[model samples]
Target: MEKFTLESQFQITGIGSASGLVYKENSLFIISDNGSFLYQFDIPYNKLTRIPLVKNAQENIPKKDKYDFESIALKGNKLHIFGSGSTAKREKEITYNLETAATEEKDLSKLYKKIKQTATLSDEDLNIEGAIFFNEKWHLFQRGNGANSKNGIAILNDNFDEKGTIEFILIELPKIKHIETSFTDAILVENKIYFLATAEDTTSTYADGEILGSIIGRIDTQTMKIDFTQKITDINKFEGLTLYNKTQDKMEFFLCEDKDSEVLETTIFKLTLDIKHN
Candidate 1:
């Protein structure tokens, strides 16, 4: 496959490091995991504005600790934000209205307890990082940074109410020494699941410290198998991705790399995919 870089790199300003992006017409909504701010940017002009979704997100967390926002998805007119804090055994999903901007937190504390009671998750398995809606279901992917476990992906029903009732389909990675791999983000494109991930030689917990490389893969939803795996190099720690339909044959993929250090900028890159051949 050939890769051609686009000219435009949308650099999001005022936001620390964005983990999620949802596009609406000419505007792009981004979620900052560190700052807990929701940013809206005008596409063409690249003008940016911010709206705080959870004020004092770091301090307000159960134990006054920080967590990554991870991933976001839009269903109808509502937006869902997923993340985990110090007290959470699993990530919590928060919903917000697009028009009204009103927010509601789904009390997943009970759900987390229920899942733990049934042995669905352990304290270490709570690092959920990617979420996407597909085939009338929401698929959540969790990253594994500890030993004796590979990264996993779980599918959930819509509304996220079937936490304990739902059976998660898990994908386990092969054990590789000194290499840390985790799924970052995902998008459904033309009946195929395109996922973004990172595999680093060093055991870095922070997103910005991960080694720069391409960890793109495709999953066959019908067979539920990872059909292809390829590496894209030079790109930094990619956190969020989405497929944008420009036309029937003219589709593009937008991805965000969370570079928190130095410039502390989130970079957006546009890429064209060859779906017909894949």
Candidate 2:
């Protein structure tokens, strides 16, 4: 197993509860789980631009009305944002066209129901926190933070049609202090899948609890098996990740933390992992 080390950490201000992250075109695209805006952080200028996800709402949406966007994935010229699906209000998906700045919304109730039935997941156990489109398939990670503690992945067709066939597979993540870790976010680089997970001391999918830190892991796409898992020494609960850069001997990823607070500040950390040689 290759080892990952923390090289540096950056504290990004004026953003709250960042749940999904993507880096492209020298800018960081972020979405908060509690807000109705998509934040764009310009890397060179260190400026933050708030793009409204909805036209009528200029301010952050209330907690009760928030869609709980938990995962964001960039596919070609489109950006896909997904809700956590832990509640009825969370069963929605927003797709934004990067090229045209056009947006489309869809109800995921039918799809979530099929996922629950196929995975045999109870209502409380169906929370998706991470997603990525790789190899023409959409891989969605179920957080498994509820009482059932069922962490798994759902593979769907690229179109993501609710009537299409959905495949579900369970994953047993490493435990931290006897508490099982659940998926938070994931990014795909080359043919490998890099994921973020955290051990939270709670069984409710809709509630927050003591975070026991986070872990980073890699999975081989061919065999669909985890190659290595490493626990981050930091106390931050990193929920979002994106590849910042890569080299022959190392890979750098940008990770963002959500402290489960309403404060308008977030921390972004630079994680470096050394590629092992035979």
Model 2 lDDT, full chain set: 0.87
Cα shift from native, residue 261, model 1 (Å): 3.3
Tens digits of per-residue lDDT, candidate 1, 76-136, equal: 8888887742145224667778889988766566644543334355654455667778788
Cα lDDT tens digits, model 2, 45-154, are 88898877776733356776778999999998988999988888899888888888888988888899999999998877899999999778899999988999998999
Scored by lDDT, model 1 comes in at 0.64
The local lDDT score (0 to 100) that residue 46 gets in candidate 2 is: 88
Off by more than 4 A, model 2? 7-9, 58-60
Once superposed on the true structure, which residue ranges of model 1 sit more than 4 Å away at CA? 1-8, 56-64, 85-90, 113-121, 162-164, 172-180, 201-209, 246-250, 260-264
